[model samples]
Target chain A: MIDFAFFLEIIPVLLAGLPLTLLLTTASMVIGFFLALLLALAQQGNRRIVIWPIRAFVAVFRGTPLLVQIFLIYYGLGQFRPSLQAIGIWWLFREPYWCAIVALSLNEAAYGSEILRGAIKAVPRGLTEAATASGMSKLLTLRLIVLPLALRNAIPNYTNEIILMVKGTSLASIITLMEITGIAQGLISQTYRAVEVFVAAGAIYLALNFAIISALNALETRLTPYRVRA
Target chain B: MTNIMHILGFQQGGWGAALLAASSVTLALSVLGFILGAALGATAAAGRLSPRRVPAWLAHVYGTVFRGVPDLLTIYLLYYGGSIALTQIGTLFGSDGFVGLPTFATGVLAIGIISGAYQGEVYRGAYQAVDRGQFEACKALGLSRYQSLRLVIVPQLMRHALPGLGNVWQLVLKDSALISVIGLVELMRQAQIGAGSTREPFIFYVAAAALYFVIAVVTASVFRFSEARAWRGMVHA
Candidate 1:
């Protein structure tokens, strides 16, 4: 008994939220990627003082649910508004959009750093040793030899993280961001056609993820030209 | 510090008891959802592995659609759509009014279906990872399919699936938090209520996060223990 016409009609409405969803995903992924790189690089050193704090950060973020993280950032931070204002950075915490971005980015960083760290560790040690033997410094060995291989290795896994971030963007709706899920929720309230509206919304997400998967697959093929095809 | 304790404490005005009760609800919801998911996952895995084309295609579609879409959207769809569908079914049976599903039931159903999709992949992978020779030996020993599956294949499959299942369990536990949006009064929802009533969101949320972390850590250790036991007497390469 689904209204086919209604399903077609809501596509344009849901598409309106596409730009914000893309923005949230891209912005958080970019920020999170850099933070994750920094974290992974820091952990390359065996210093307990440095790695312990990062380990704790990853454990806490990965252990708790992202919804709790979002609520903690948005409403919980309001509890410390005066102190934040005094510190001159209350502007970042003031908007729900910013709060969502912060939480999403932090969450992505925890997961992404682990993926990147594993990739980095998987790089062949002989290659790096050979690079160092050829008059390259440790920094050069990492930059010229280790990083490229690790990044290529990391792409397949990072694609999953990216898809996850795209999915994670839907949670922004809960904090009133007017994203796809937000608009769909609004439409459902008005029309009481939850199934149709959600089906349309889910279609949009499915399309987005499919595109992402294809692009990453293409990237993986392009980067690993040396890979043997079975 | 004392004020923080007073608010979270088990005293008259404290929210400790309420939060504790809500955590139990969260645990129950997740455990039930996970068990349901495991059953669905096994069925879906069987479908995927079947020689028939239709079931394999249907199972593939289920995995792709569920895995691609957000869990929040699925929960919302089920929460809103279930009642509507139920009412229509009720009307067909001559029972008139809107037949709404309870929030807890909806939550469990949502989590079950979503986790089932992921668990299907885990089970399929584990099935493939079972050594080919074992199956050959089972056939050579003149064992029937059901007997071999029950006695030989399934145990090894469970052993291989343990790590993946542990991951899915954590995912299901975390997803139970989203059930709060539908107002199930679990840990997340209880924290929200306490935050609103007491106007102390930071404390309540921090406390809630700690509780979730503890649960995750404890369950993880249990999985690790079982994994170690499962690996007992096995030779490692």
Candidate 2:
């Protein structure tokens, strides 16, 4: 009745696939951060052209489910094989890994842009005005004052976004990416013991998220030393 | 554009009708799950706020475990485990051997459990947001607890809870896609089926995404309108 041997066999296999999950999360977060930063910065000075398009883009990306987005990017785009081949980008489009990354990064950019915008808004107007009065150039003000404060303020929201990305990476499994959950599903097909294998996968995901949370919390404390002192 | 239109058309080969039906199923599942979650959430939220030891402990465990794990695992467990549990129950009740569990029921159960975890937090937060002084005032006026709750606490809690509940509904809607893995013919599953059958993965998947986008945008606007109406008289900065 016991399946201790089965558990032993699957744990290592599932762990092997965790790196892809982590890689997707990290790469997408980094890429999304840059894209989000650019969008957030662009939305600052312009309300007519730049802001509207970004707003629409963010709304579409954030409003819908990640599963739909992933399917659209992976299977949906695969329908354009001929066009992609014509454009010489079929190699990239043909791979599920690239599709997963693209979907995750675009999703994160929408959310990260919102967080960045909020952080920018939270920056006290008085400080920005004082910088302006002090003859600090716009670029210098952004580098020295605006970004540091915004980054500090955005830490909590960003942590939420990061953990969400970690969870969202599991959706890649639907597209045949053998991440942790995908491997777990495979194990279930092999063993027919749903509870134990899922529990193992859940434990893995929870452990990873827990580590991220603790690290982010420490970063938050380090970034806001005043809070630690208080 | 012509190819896109033809693939999405209502012809025998087209997936538009099938995907649309699946979207309806997704909507139905979300509503069912949201309602189920609200009931459980209310109970859990009350238990959490109760001045008792046992209920608080139960509530604590439920919240912690459900919130800590990924929703996908929760869904997978429900989808696979649900049939096993249901078949056992059916046999116990003297039904035919191996009573089947539909994917829709399984999907609803999964979505409900996950949404309940979130709804519990929302209700708990909303309960805390209810002004304590009003309860005191109602008591001063000699209103019974049920009457006071029905007249005062419930309305305020519902208003504050609306936005959070709306958020959980959207979350539930999106998460319904996960149930497709269990072979539920929801939107994503339908899209997958269309992709395989038509060999037009790109067209079908994009259409599915667009359908989801439309639903999300419309529902979000409705929730926003309700929030505005609910808080019409109150001043919020």
Candidate 3:
């Protein structure tokens, strides 16, 4: 059982880091969404030569642990300081924050690309045919017709992915970015009260997830305002 | 050339073999964890499905607590607090002091507990997916609970459960990587060692990532094949 008084002490301290946690989560999801869009579009069977490699890239990113990716990006790239200095990009690599963002964005992009691909494939063929029949070019048809339908079809699943990404942002704490989990870990180390600190952190995460869930549920209802009566 | 040779060569110094062995450790841990999770998951699923309030509440609390927290935090709590708890219990029995948990067992248990929460949900869904008519018919045929579960229910549930279990296996495999933070000599830890010694984290981390990718893809393919075989005669809606 958790002591509520101990939790009352820790909750405020952990909430101080909520801004950074939310920032990383939203920033990565937005950036990753765009990258995934471009990749999904580029890999939709036009460029066979590029398809295999892009598929391989997605596979590798999705397959490996995100923690390894973060460690590799931070420490692994730090080993290339001389080269980075020559290119004047050393400053970005020096900060753990930037590295965490890059790694999170890349990992989410790979997973998001798959989600987008599945949604795109599920688009009704006749809609695209109708768009094409109206003298629309491939690009225009994709932009106006396919993407909207795919996105609407994908909202439910995509919302779940967003929530997952929010949870995954906790891993960035390992590389010394003081997100919620990191702060909680620090508190536990100082106070030697693992249960209390962790309980507070878990409550914070559950609250955040609950908010996301309810928000998405409302969005789903509003998006499909017309419901069929059984 | 000498530098490359030194890095590659093994004389109680090189990391090539250590990293490979660590990868094997990761695989072994995941296999054990998955099995343990399956057992726990079944128990939890049964609890959730039971009419008794205590069992249902137990299952609910287990699923909610594990799913709500970050898996990394859970692992950290276990790594730090598990030994202390065990030693306390040992002291109660007049045993020796400080009963340390081995890294592998700790890692396995942490992963098992985390994955069990997910597996419970999957199993509950799969159980519910079984045709209601089948259950009614089993009862009408005078089958005992165990007999019905074994002959009429479990087979169908397993079929529905396989795809979900595949996803859980993947999750367990990736989560096993998180155990490296506790100084487990797993792939990520081995990569850290090689990185520190050789000052070439980029190469070794990339290599580790490659190995993980290979394992994930291979396991995914095997799961896909099994799912296909299991669903061969059935029509999917």
Candidate 4:
């Protein structure tokens, strides 16, 4: 009952969509990381006004599903086309690719900032105090001492978020970007073999995630040599 | 603003009731999936903890594949592949017509399977956190394995598992939105319909998001309360 030959044939076809999927993942992750850093750092300040808005932003994005965010950004924003055009940025909203990137990046920022905040908080106070006591500026201390340590601490959790972003790019198919899932769905429509197509697609995703997990595992080990058990 | 209110109002030509009903369907779908996941999780956790090599290896494969793959793909697989598999079984049983799985059942099964993978890990971690001395004490008391497990081990397991399971519940709740892809009339699909019909995609989508946020917030507090209750009278670390 299994279409082994057809599955083998479709693997190459599905691989054709891998570039777009990787592009979406990388673009969103890079953009989101910067935004998350800003949000995480802003969260460190004692001001209520800055902190509350950041908290609300994280809550809204984290509370709602990524599908809703994609829909809201893609179709929902389309309803305000004239205003968007007036702002001279309708071009960005018009493309499904950009919309997906924006939605994915925003969603990533929400979760990533929380992970980063925890990592930043986990950085021992004594280390930062030492940097400050050595006649270092706050900016210098953050750049030279706190950030590197916090980033290393953040790697494991951040790796999970990156995997999630990769998986999330699949939702872009709903908006018509031809990612791997999108290509598989297209093939299923033509071939009427949903099982084979999806299995092939799922295998591709599994392979991608395995690669990501291994690479991240290696990175984690490399960054934490001091923690290596004898 | 007035137009938004009117469109969302619970009056003639308004979609407030439909949205509310759809939100309930979303909630019901999530709760059902979560319940199903808990059962599967327990079984998988048991398999992982078993002394047998094959069951543990099988459990490991199950967790890795399900957790590593995207939930959307899992939903699609169940929705499409499940029907085909059911028809094959039906034919073997001498039925001629197709035996399609209902969309709601497929949604529950997909979410249950996906969440079960994560929940299994949570259970395994929580199980490890249970003190080894607790088992010794149970044995010292001459409690049977079944009695000790049901009365002693499970409670401690749950106390540690509550926080992790809370995170899993949030994930399951969000994942339920993908059920809309298979044409389930949950909150996301209902919002799509409302948006298409009214051409006010912004308002409907925003309303749907607000409804989701409310559910998430309310359920999160419920988890928090339960966690507190579970830890009541426990000594602080």
TM-score of chain A of each: 0.97, 0.94, 0.94, 0.96
Better of 1 and 3 by lDDT: 1
lDDT of 1 by residue, B1-237 (tens): 998999999999999999999999999999999998998899889989999999999999899888889999998899878877887899999998878779999999999999999999999999989999999999999999999999999898888999999999999999999999988999999999999999999999999999999999999998899888888889987
Measured with C-alpha atoms, the lDDT of residue B139 in candidate 1 is 98
The two-chain DockQ for each candidate, comma-separated, is: 0.82, 0.59, 0.66, 0.74
Clashing pairs in 4: none
lDDT of 2 by residue, A62-127 (tens): 878898788787777777789999999988778999989999999999999999999998999999
Candidate 2 chain B lowest-lDDT run of ten: B79-88
State interface RMSD in Å for all models. Answer: 0.8, 1.7, 1.3, 1.2
Can you rank all candidates by lDDT, best first? Answer: 1, 4, 3, 2
Q: Can you write out model 4's per-residue Cα lDDT over B11-125, one digit (the tens) per residue? A: 9999999999999999999999999999989889999999999989988988987887777877777876777778779899999986767989888998899999999999999
| Residue-level lDDT tens digits of model 1 in A1-230 | 76788877889999999999999999999999999999999999999999999999999999999999999999999899999999998999999999999999999999989999999999999998899779899899989899999999999899899898988999999999999988888887677788788879998999999999999989999989878497
RMSD of each: 1.6, 2.7, 2.7, 1.8
The lowest-lDDT stretch of 10 consecutive residues in candidate 3 chain B is B3-12
* Candidate 2 displacement at residue B51 in angstroms: 3.4
Per model, how much of the real contact set is kept? 0.75, 0.64, 0.67, 0.71
Please tell me which predicted candidate would have the highest TM-score against the true structure: 1
lDDT score for residue A170 of model 1:
90
TM-score, structure 1 vs. true: 0.97
Candidate 2 vs candidate 4: which has greater lDDT?
4
